[model samples]
Target: MNAGHQTTRRLAAGAGKSICRSCRDSLSRNYASAAAAAVQTEDHVSQHIPPVAQASPQTSYQVNAGVVLSRPPQITRDLHPFESAFFLYQRRLNERSALPFTRYFYYKERTPADREWKRKIKQRLTPARDIGRYKGYGEEAWNDEVLVGAKESDFNWQVERLLEDAETTGVEDQPAQELTETTPSPLAQKKVEHEAVERPMSRITEADKKNDVKSLNRLLQRTLYFLVKNKEGQWMFPQDGLQKETLKEAAHRVLEYSAGVNMNTWIVGNVPIGHYQLDYPTSRKTESGLNELGLKTFFMKARIMAGQANLKENQFGLQDFQWLAKEEVKTQVEDKYWRSIKNMLAER
Candidate 1:
């Protein structure tokens, strides 16, 4: 009975081992078939694949460097009406709160200078507190001038007229013309003449008056830019194609080549301040002998410190030029071009 049981156990163990071996063989065959199918699919795809197409003449945008040359404000801006009134009020307030004139310190006691100063002050100026107390306004009022007084309600005149009426009579303020008996001494007269007033030049220039757009002297208080009309009769900033140089170097060349080498301009930096991508259908040929589909323009900032543009050479094939303010530039150029460079201009 024991021998029979051992034989039965051996047979069962052999059958289980044979079954495990068959399952392993089937898995290996399935994996091998799948790999072969994948290889065949890859070969079919490779046979059907198309050749890579080459780039045409206009594979990309043509790199261009544009210069935004500007003349900064030459003078301070004019004060608006409200600004003027505010400044006037501030000056008056300061004058009102100021310390009284130290007569003894500024002038000697009872000397000719002191006597002249006293006479002048009494002749010209009247105290605001002492005004209207008496009808007489002293000797300051002239025969032809109207009699003036500061009133409590201030109804005799508006602020536009008779402002600070008691401050100065604006008469006989000049040094005595003749060196007669009542005139100041020779030394005093000489001193007065020595400190004679000098009038300042007007802010408005002849260029502004004549509306000369070429002159740099116009628009003293606003930034003025350089614009030129191209052969197409469109106004734009001076620009040129890049070649074997950095963006800033290209800008300097553009300014010199287009605007002329006479200008004393300094580019602000190596990096561009603004960029404009234009789809310009250009007939101009590139080094590749192919037409450029468009231009990728990078704008660099430059300031004109001294000299002006020399458009006489016409090296850039320009039609006309102008030095105009930002608003004027917007009016001259196309709307799309204006939108691209609008923020690059100085607000002042």
Candidate 2:
């Protein structure tokens, strides 16, 4: 009872002292932290308050200096009614008179030498043999005959005989002398001259004359029928069909002719007179011979026309005609270009 109890009491006293010391250390730390926080808060307040006061005047002065001067109020005067109307009318007239790129087409047409050269080159290469054959000169077999001063009728006869021989023997390499080159009958010469005079000025060579007429006839017939069918509505030709290089060439010829001129004739139209400011290369062949906006306008019109029109089907269940109308055909040519751009973007 004496020794064990005393030892236990001593251990409890030591533990109590240790707990009190720990509590005192915690209190001291808490007080020190609180003091430091108070000092920091005072410093922050002091710093911010002086800056705010000091900067307020300067900021106010700067803002006041930066203020823009108010502009004077405009006069409330209005134009007279007649003046307004006249101005509007003049503006409209100016707008109507201003053709954007139509002048370029007319200018290009006026200068026919370049087109003639191009046509000649094409004729020299392809020769429009089918047309020549139909005209009585088997293909362009009479090119040399015509060049050699053979009479028109004589050339025609030679062409007919050559075509007949070619058809029968499936060979176009017949001897030149073997093809009869008799003197042309007077009646035949007169007929040839009359037809030649009546023919539209085109890039058509003598060999291509018959073929051009035949092709034109086919196109005209198809166009007429298509138009008749859609007499009550508008129509558009599919651009994809006319987008062929050959067809484009044909279209260019048609356009050239429709503008009231050809490869040999001067341009005759209500051509606008203005300096053409082309944003693109003039030498390059554009879809509608117009800029991006013009092309868009054309396509939109075409889409409207196509939506309103009825599509004609041929005996073979194919579209017999290439272009429905000039506008539609122009649109078809232009739509392909924008669609191509859209496709490229989608891929990216």
Candidate 3:
């Protein structure tokens, strides 16, 4: 062949050698990897086998000792009395209660109609508020002892007024009767004394008195109130939870989270105005991992200095909010909870 043909054959030969070398290197790597895997498999089997099957008894002993030393020891200490009490309280709060450990509400002023409406509502419900089977003995006893007592006092005041009118009329007509018959015996004297003793005193009882004008005047300032609809659809004051926070912090956070009131627009009070217990449905025994059937909720109240409840799109499940008038609140809230709210609003 020619010189060019010879050169072409040499180049082809070099290419074939390079290809063969690459294939050899790949095969060698695969064999080395397979040998390493086989060795690992044997080691694994040896470790899992019984100690008697092992080559050396000392090796098994050493492996067991290493495992024991690798594990860390668990240590615990007993809590202090106060600390234990606090933990117990917190545990109860967790197991028996819903998320919100406390609540805060905002109250403005009240109108004249508001005060009047509250007073009338209280009067209407006072007689039978605790008469239902749902009420406990404590509530029944309180109603009988306190509310019934006040009613009796008012009745006595009216009787006293009637007695005063009778005494006056008797004195005026006594002269005419004296001319007709002059029978003044000790029996008649005793009867008169008896009538006097049975008659009501002229003084007015506390129950008969009205709300002072000054106190009512303070409430009659056309104050607007605010309430929020909870996840349950009950209308209540905007509230939030307390997570290891002070009452004020929790209140402000509640205003922000539930009411969606911006910090710049909203003004909040530092101190809480009132407090109350909120009744919530307890979780089922299976769900709560406890036998308790009730939840203990503690609520607090605070005054909204300024800003309206502008609930945002992502607010805490708050369906809606409103700047409610007194009449609106009376229609919205239940009687028992409203009494506490009315007291807060009508506070002097």
Candidate 4:
């Protein structure tokens, strides 16, 4: 019975081992098939797909230096008449104090209609009957004389009237010579002259020399306009009271001391466009430190003549010099100041 049992056990064990070996073989084959299929799929994909081309690092650096790095051209435009007038007047005025001032004229560019109109009217306009009257003067000469001589004469007349008024009580009254039989002392004469000068209504008369009158008149009439820049990149024309210097002296110093220009080379005209008043608040200390509401400023026009402005170190902290046209000035300057500038330009 024991021997039979052993035979049965052996047979059972052998069968179990064979079954296990078969299962192992099937698993190995399935794994091998799956790996082969995956390899095939990868190979097929790689053959069908194109390789991506990488961008070259060198191409981006191929910028043309000549084309991209050239300097920009300068932009400029024709100067306005005021600028030219300033130049001319400055040069002339510097040479002589009393200049025969005349309005500068420019030839208007005629349109097609204007040309046709002039052509039609040309034949109808008769030549002057009295040629002898215009014998010494051609059209150009006549125009020059009418503009220059007439203006000079008018200026002289105005100056004479002003001077006459300074000495006499009124035009209707007796002449100053008749009124005062005794010759006045030199000191009294000087006192009268000083009084007349201080009084705005007092006329500067013919008794005053042309140079003195011109200088004094310029001191009264001329305004010194200067452009200043601040740290924040804003622009302004700075002006202050005539602290110490005379008008002509101040004008020269404004260029020399403030603007740092070579005043010896640069010239300026005596005839200014006009004057305008500005008011502002101030701080005062009478009994106690207090804020005052009383400060006044008079701005007058001064035109540049010959040399360019060579800026210097100034208290106003100006960065650059500029000539703004009326239109540009109107946009940048304050309303009250712009109005003054506009009026001055209009006088041109």
lDDT per residue, candidate 4, 285-331, as tens digits?
Answer: 33334443343433334444434445566554566644433354466
lDDT of 1 by residue, 57-134 (tens): 455678889999999998999777555545444544443443255667767987876765555554535323222222
Clash pairs for candidate 3:
none
Tell how far residue 205 is off in model 3, in angstroms: 43
Number of the candidate with higher TM-score, 2 or 4: 4
The best candidate by lDDT is 1
Least accurate 10 contiguous residues by lDDT in model 3: 62-71
- lDDT by residue (1-348, candidate 3, tens digit) is 543445445555777655565565565566666667888999999999867653532211100000000001112223454554454344333423332222112222354444333333333332122121112235443322223333223434435544543343132224435522433454335333213336533333332264331111222323445566778998776655456767655655666666554423333344555554544354344332444333322344444443444566536687776554466567888786677556555311
What TM-score would every model get versus the actual structure?
Answer: 0.66, 0.14, 0.31, 0.30
Rank list by TM-score: 1, 3, 4, 2
lDDT of each candidate versus the true structure: 0.71, 0.31, 0.44, 0.40
After superposition on all CA atoms, what RMSD does each candidate show versus the true structure?
A: 11.1, 30.1, 27.8, 26.3
lDDT of 4 at 30: 64
Clashes of each: 0, 4, 0, 6
Give per-residue lDDT, candidate 4, residue 205: 32
Worst 10 residues of 1 by lDDT: 127-136
What stretches of model 2 exceed 4 Å from their correct place?
1-156, 163-232, 237-348
